[model samples]
Target chain A: MKILVVDDEADIQPLFLQHFRKELRHHDFEFDFALSGEEALEYLKGNSLEVVLILSDINMPGMSGIDLLSKIRQDYNYLSPVVMMITAYGDEENYKQAMEKGADDFLTKPLDFNLLKEKLKKVMNNG
Target chain B: MNFDYILLLIVFSYLRRALQSKILLPKIDKYLAIGFWFSIVLLIAGFFLKFTKEINAWIAHAMLFTLIYFCLTQKEFKSVKSFIYSILPFVVVNFIEDCIELINSPFHDEWNNYFDTAIFFSIVWFFAMFFITRKQRKEMEKEQLKAIEFEKEFQQSEILKAKLETQVAERTAEILGQKEKLQKALDKLKTTQVQLIQSEKMASLGELTAGIAHEIQNPLNFVNNFSEVSSELLDEMNEEIVKGDFEEVKNIAIDLKKNLEKINFHGKRADSIVKGMLQHSRIGNNVKEPTNINKLADEYLRLAYHGFRAKDKSFNADLVTDFDENLPKINVLTQEIGRVLLNLFTNAFYATHQKQKKSGETYKPMVSVKTELKGKGIEITVKDNGIGIPEAIKDKIMQPFFTTKPTGEGTGLGLSLSYDIIVKAHGGTITIDSRENDYTVFTIFLPTE
Candidate 1:
């Protein structure tokens, strides 16, 4: 499975790669990282719908995670990625924002990777 | 005859007749006034002077007394008492004259022969004294009438002065009343101005808080996600160590150390957010600029919806927006107005979300935003299918610190701050329409010009 991670911070790339080490070794998952929503959109322009999953951070430098979700819902909705939004506040506002923009799931930080993994498995199983 | 002599005879005839009429003389049958005058002339010309001289001075006194009685007894005189009073001065004069005559007669026997002269002088003196007393009395009566007329005029002026004073007092009271009313109106205006200022403060605070919330949440996302994944990595390393996989364990520790770095980085990022919050507040000045209101409203509405979904995954709602194609861009404070839109959209979603909870899956939560062209301005409406605001709290919804959301869930400043931004700052209007358990719609009117 190919997955995309969109965040403004550079630190997230290393963290995501390390966490998914077992899956990558087994060829169970492949990952791509974009520093911003604009970068993510640029990358997707070349490789449309190749990534099946999208994990995004709500706050970003240029276009926000919600904006990316909206663009994805608009352009890639026919053969779309399962989009999930991550939030730090666990604030209801961001939760509703993610859902309103067609987010398939949402997680609050400090994220419980176990819960995230379980949710991913369920989405994957359901898909 | 000479003219003077004839005129004097005619005058004497009239005077003699006048005296005869006063003495109750008999009237003739025809031309009685002429007959009396002719008879008086004949009697006087032929006999009066002769008889007056032959008669004693006592008989002359009796004739004069009768003339006086007739004159005084006239209707205009009112009483004969005054005619009798005329005799007093005459009687005193008569006594003085008699004493002089008696002394003169003893000194000169010729005084008896000149007695006619004495009588004539005494009669002239008596008449002159009577005329002087009458003239003095008439003068006294004229002065009394003048005093009465002056008193009447004084009384009329006093009444006029009193009326003028009443009018002046009434006009003074009217002016004081107008001044008092103006003061009260000024006081009311000041109160409204104060309320507007307070609302502005609340709006600024709301904008600042949203900034702080958005800034801090991102780093925290990183910090929390890395910490959560770290323990799982440690577990993996422990399992790898049991399999004697030292290289894998080393890789796991490195991953764990990297994760810790991320946590540290994001932790500091959150700390920096605190400093940034202060800076945000200090720098916040609402400056208006040209903005496409439709794009702005759409963006904030999406943000609000997603933010709500992030907190409660089970919560769901449909958001719809209808934008006028002809709507023009207008100048506005972007951040402040953005905060107001965010707050309104948030409330719409929250209300519907609450209703969805009670009504279950059959209930479809829907929130809509609509913008239209309204003369000289734009009208935006935010509507939702939700458990409506109760009638009791409706009026107070825009008041500061008044909230229906439970204790920790809401600060209750959302609507009030939004009210300040849209209505006070923008010189706009906000009105609400709602029904219990039905729906709520908030209409906003903003001037484009």
Candidate 2:
């Protein structure tokens, strides 16, 4: 399985890498990182690999996660990727927007690895 | 004794007539004078005809009648006095005639017969004058009695006028006291209004502070996240450098490219928060511009709740959108409206979360935000199913510094500042409807044209 993670936070990638590397022994998964929405779009344009999961953070400086999600939905609404939104604040408006932008699930952070793993299992099955 | 009594009675009759003239017939001095002379003539005729008993008895009766008349007419005593003065000369002349008849009794024989006649005439004249004087004295007594009654009445009227004046003074004092109390109440009301205004101003400042903290914190989180990643990349690079592994260093260098890009990403975020703050706090400059409300509301609502989430990772609300495609843009301050939306969404979350915390009643609270075109205006509604507002506190919630939230969680100016932004600043309206434990909806209307 291949996953694309779009976040402005550099620390988030390592956190994911550490958690995923410890959990998955099959070595069947590959990970890609984009620091911003524009970079994420650029990376999508360059890559031909089929990505199954996309985890994104909504707030960023320019071309926010919502905008990126909107663009992604516009381009590939039919793609059955399990897109999960990771955020620090647990407000309804953002959750609603993320879903409207074609996000499949939502997770709030202090980075619970166990919860993420459970959510990934469900999302992978669904995908 | 009979002649003396007759004279006294006649004299009293004349006095009564004189007093009556003075009191009742004051305007008819001529008639009073004629009547006095006529009485004197009757006295003289009585002596000549030898009718002393008849004349004396009639005079005695007339005297009593005159006294009664004088008593009745004594109310006009001043006029009666003038009439009596006018008859004074005639009374003296009659007295002189009486004296002459009395003195001629000294001659004897032929004079003795004359002397006897003159003595009777003299006695009749003297009695008539005596009766007039007695009547005058009684009339004077009657006049004095009337004067006493008038004096008593005058004193009573004076007392009444004095009492009325005192009452007027008391009423004036009472009215002045009431006016003073009203003025004091008015002063207290003015002070209370001023305090309310002052506290409202302070609350706005507090909201601005909290908003700044919240906005800036988003970028700070990014900074913290990015910095940790960059430090890890550097640590890996250092390990590759110490081992003198050029091929691994090249791969790490390529890996560091994405982490370096994150520095730019997080830096720009911090800049935007500062910029939003600058725009939000700019005062006294009218920067109202035409803005699409639907776009603004959707964007800010998302941003306001950008990082919020549920504890159960599976739960998510169904979002329904109903944007009016025909709605025209309106002149507005975008950042102000953004702040207003932020406050509203924050309140919605607070309400819904509280409901979720309550035992046995944890129905997944739904928040609906809708926009509609309403006759040259736009109506936006933010509705939530949560612990709703109470009727008693509904009106007070719009007042500044009034909060239902726990301490440190609320500044209480959220709705009030939102009220000011929509209604006072934009010339729009904000209305709230809520039922306990059912739903709370805030509707805002802004003119499109």
Q: For residues B18-109, what per-residue lDDT tens digits would candidate 2 score against the true structure? A: 44656666665454455456555555656676656455435534543463355346664443443444333333333333344446534344
lDDT of 1 by residue, A2-121 (tens): 788887678778766767778789877788999888899999998775788899987653366887899999998888689999765566778887898899998866566667767767
Quick one: best DockQ, which candidate?
Answer: 1
**How would you class the docking of model 1?**
incorrect
Q: DockQ of each model against the real complex?
A: 0.19, 0.07
For each of the candidates, give the backbone clash count.
26, 20
lDDT of each residue in B334-427, candidate 1, tens digit only: 7677767778887888899899889985787898999999999989999999998889989999997788989867777778878988888899
Error of 2 at B396 (Å): 8.1
Cα RMSD for candidates in order: 15.9, 12.6
- Who wins the TM-score comparison? 2
Single out the weakest 10-residue window by summed lDDT for candidate 1 chain B: B1-10
